[model samples]
Target: MVEETIKLAYGEYSDLIKDKRIAAVQALSGTGACRLFADFQKRFSPNSHIYIPVPTWSNHHNIWRDANVPQRTFHYYHPDTKDLDFASLMDDVKFSQNAPKGSFFLLHACAHNPTGVDPTEEQWKEMSYQFKVKGHFAFFDMAYQWFASGDPEKDVKSIGIFLEDGHLIGCS
Candidate 1:
């Protein structure tokens, strides 16, 4: 399957992803891609950790664990308000020392699966800057790109922020 077509059809930053700098590979599913990435992470950044939101795809934990990659948790959803929990998320990110280098962070591009909440543009920009400072890698999963807002551009805004900041990204 042609990823470029998929990107263009969804209108989710197809041009940027199509740039010669990116390297794309085929996967049977998101879980498969995550598993492959987990294995790759183990090989390339053996000491690096994979930071996932407190609540993400349940399969995420299994994929990384089965791949032999050490897993770490970061703040995301607020138990009380059931919202973005931006402050706690930032606090966790700011205080995270484990993301020293070569660390991978999993981000939901849009329509957060379970929470159905996403960070604002301002929040995304802040996180992008923070990640830049920490030298961390971002892995975005855009499965629900158009399902949330019915507009792909709005859905993938976070990823665009990273690209604008000159960050290399991997997505599935």
Candidate 2:
């Protein structure tokens, strides 16, 4: 089940899958997965902080807090337009008075909670490029895998983009 799940998210032909580079474990649920990752992040990157987007799932805050991981907020939703605050988000991602290089970010893989807005493929590519340039780490919350496009394969395009850019990512 774990292997199959990894293939579903990372693509069946992914070299990471074939090379056994992914470390995965089954969790009770999406919240469980997120909490486990938070714990792992706190344990491994003790001094690092997690950058979460504003207007995300409320549980995100609680989970990270319980894990004792420091939290930082980045722009995400624009209340006026009811859409993504792309410019501000980019500014944060680029570390403009926000997180530093090698910072960890929590990204919604698709069907972002509450807002239901997902970045376009081009935006994902740009984000991946910036992440590479800034040495940022992406921790994807893929709880709504097929909810964005109604196709699991297509919904995971963001992750694929990061992978294509040679990023070692974490997904839940």
- Output the number of the lDDT-best candidate: 2
Candidate 2, lDDT over the whole model: 0.92
lDDT by residue for model 1 (1-172), tens: 6566456433445565556456668887778877878887889888878899989989889998999888898889988997889988877666656455556899998888788889989999999998888778998887787788897677778888998898987777
Segments of candidate 2 deviating more than 4 angstroms: none
| Per-candidate TM-score against the hidden true structure | 0.90, 0.97
Model 2 agreement with the true structure over 37-113: per-residue lDDT tens digits: 99999999999999999989999999999999999999999999999998899999996469799999999999999
Every candidate's CA RMSD: 2.1, 1.0
lDDT of each: 0.80, 0.92
User: What TM-score does prediction 1 earn?
Assistant: 0.90
